[model samples]
Target: MSQQQTTLHVELGDRRYPIYVGASLLSASNLIAGAIKGRQVVVVTNETIAPLYLDTVLRQLPDTMLVTSVILPDGEQYKTWQTLGDLFDQVLAARHNRSTTFIALGGGVVGDITGFAAACYQRGVDFIQIPTTLLAQVDSSVGGKTAVNHPLGKNMIGAFYQPTAVVIDTSTLATLGEREYAAGLAEVVKYGLIYDPEFHRWICANRDLLAARDVDTLRHAIQRSCEIKAEVVAADERESGLRAILNLGHTFGHAIETHMGYGSWLHGEAVAAGMVMAVRLSAMRGSVDVDLVVELEQLLVDLGLPVWAPQDMTSATFIDLMALDKKVIDGQMRFVLLNALGSAVVVDDVTEAELTALIDG
Candidate 1:
């Protein structure tokens, strides 16, 4: 491990794992090798990422360890059963066993599918997350909520499998396009809105630094976001209770992703708009002040995130798509709403009329 690396533990009793956050972590071969559980390894990545970092990762593995690579076509549209089957094909063709470790070497799409593949392949296997994008580094890569998108809904098919470790290299953010980088700021803003108001304020204060990709600012943001998610996942690994708070904007966001088609609006972009919708709903229900909604919207806007659902999407369409969301319980849609700034709760009491009004108006 590098001296500058920040390590946070996701405490899940025996399933606990360390999240390493810092710069140049991709070069830490010992750190990468230490997390693997067996002699055989398969590094799962996408075509877009393989050309950039696959060789670097392969070189990190011990010479004695058998390492193979599976590179899938890049995009959210590719995150499906067919793509997952491709991963399985590679593993089966290589004759890998349960002891084989799967290393995810791209962003959230790569991490989610790879982790889900690890969860189902031969019942289960160990996996490592080397999240290269800001969105994955701050949120998706740390949580272990792995899955692929279904045409009807997002993450409807998935598991609660945990990773052996998460290695985040801030240097990777340098390669990200302007839009992708902005999308990540949405998830970073989520931790602040739902759990730490102070963190939210800090992000508001550091917008320029964050946009500029300042290393110190990103390291702190990634570490804090991981810390918040680690604590939540430790308490509720399966989204039974407290963990649902982490999905503050996801319910509506997933609906957008499903309705618009995956890869259309980035996950974080959809979530940013979804969060604005949630905040608007909260204000309509008298759960929070309208000023709070305005404040949150402005923050997201300042960070280059969309605060409105797409103009083409109807309220009824949102309702239809959201009904298929994973948060639905006993046929009732459960929404994560803010009780106040820095606090959130899941409620099933929201009426269809209320949601329709919120979406339409």
Candidate 2:
């Protein structure tokens, strides 16, 4: 961690953690090692990410630990029970006890699987989220939501297990493709739309900086998103009410992921398309102006995000898929809809006809 690096704290009673963000954080093994200060570490990553940053993270870890690694094939489709089992097998095979730490050293997919693995292994263990993807850095890696996908739905079986520390090295974002980077921006944008209007305006004003990956611009965006998410998580750890707000575009996004087949469209891509659909849905509710949809869609489009679903999925089919979102309670589909550009409302009474019209329109 450099002197210039900014730290965002997630104060949760005694289970508090810190999010470290900056350019060269990955190299600050001494600082990271000091925080966890443990003896047994298992860095869980994927084929794609392993060849890149895993070794660098392991090298930085304190000498007190015996670092082992389990590499899985990278992608959303791999975030499953069987893949999670790989970590369990490694932990068991390595004779690691409950004290063994798990490090998620990849994107959201790796972080989710690693976190869920940490939650299940020996009933639970400490894990560090070293998220490499833009999406993971801004959203998944910060929140305590960890899961493996069921054939039925995305993140259907998971736990709300917080990490010991969230080590976000923005330099890792350099490896991301154009589409992947844009996908992450969708999530970063979501935080502003849901809670901070000023951040939203900052995003709109400096869209070019974000698109070009300006260091200062990216850092602030990630920091704000994490701070907002951390606060919401601490208040409603189980997502009873407040935490559900974090799933603003997730309901529709999950549907896009499921219907399109996981891995075909990136999570951020699905969320981008999903957010556009949400704006249209909000417009139909008359809570938000039609221009909001136009603006949101255009921004995402200009960012190279997908603003529509695949042709194979019809409007009605998409609605049916959305009904299966994790946020649904008592068979009511709760939606986080924008009431204004910067504020949002949770409404479950949205009509299916309205959904079809918004999507089909």
Candidate 3:
């Protein structure tokens, strides 16, 4: 690893894997080469990202290896069983086998679909995560929660298959659009809200630097976020208990994504709004002060994120969509709500009246 690079690992015992975060690490063929489990490699990415970083990644693999690149259309709408089937078709046509190591080289949409493909293809194959977006770098690419969306609910079908390694090159953020970059920050801010109060205050204090995309600020943010997630995943790999806290705003956010149609709102954008609603509900339960909700809303607004759900979405809409959420168990609905700033809990006792008030009020 270079002096500029930071490496952390997800401790899944024999299945443990490393996450590399740094500047220009994509050019480091050694890191990429070291993670491959076999001589055959398959790279899965989207059209938008393929043009940007695919070649650089391809260059890292030796010519002696069988490297096939499958590029799909970009967008959340493309994350479906059909796209996944198309990817399998291309890989099979190229004669890839169980020995192939798949690499995911894009943002969340690309990463999730690719990871899920790796999990199911040939009964599971080793895959590396080359997450190019901030959201993927800090969140999705780390945990083993791989899946594609369904019309009724988000990430409804998937597996707990982990990656062999994760490579996050900070330089890719330079090419990201403003909206996408801000969307990623929503996840970064979520780390502070759920696990670290000091980090939360630091984020609020350094909003300008974060907005400016200062190199050091971003590195620290990505590294710390990964560390928190790593610790959590190490403790609860399958989200059986402790890990559910990671979805602090995701329950409400997923409902929004499904109701609005996939791709209508970025995942992080919906989560930003959802976090506020969760915090508002926490205040209603008297677990956290109402003032904290205002502070979080202000911070999200300052970071150029939405702090409210869509104008047309109603309590009825949210209830209907969220009822289909994957987190629901045995006819009971579970939600991750803040018990306090930097503390989150999963509760199943939230009454329908409370939810209606939280949404309609």
| Candidate achieving the largest TM-score | 3
lDDT of 3 by residue, 27-48 (tens): 8648998898789999999889
lDDT of 3 at 56: 91
Count of backbone collisions within predicted model 3: 0
**TM-scores across all candidates?**
0.97, 0.96, 0.98
Cα deviation at 303, candidate 1, in Å, is: 1.3
Ranked by lDDT, top first: 3, 1, 2
Each prediction's Cα RMSD? 1.3, 1.5, 1.1
lDDT of 1: 0.90
lDDT of 1 by residue, 5-87 (tens): 88899999999999988888898647898888799999999999999999888988889987889999999999999999888
Query: lDDT of candidate 2?
Result: 0.84
| lDDT tens readout by residue for model 2, 1-361 | 4556888888787889989888878886465676665588888889998889877877887666777889999788888898887668877888888888888989989999989988988899998998888999989998788999999999988998989899888888888999899999999889888888898888888888899999888888888888888888888888777777777888888888888888988888888888887878878778788987887887888778888877777778876887777777888988888888777778889887777777666
On a 0 to 100 scale, what is the lDDT of residue 90 in model 1? 80
Q: Which regions in candidate 2 have their CA more than 4 angstroms from the true location?
A: 1-3
TM-score (C-alpha, index-matched) for candidate 3: 0.98
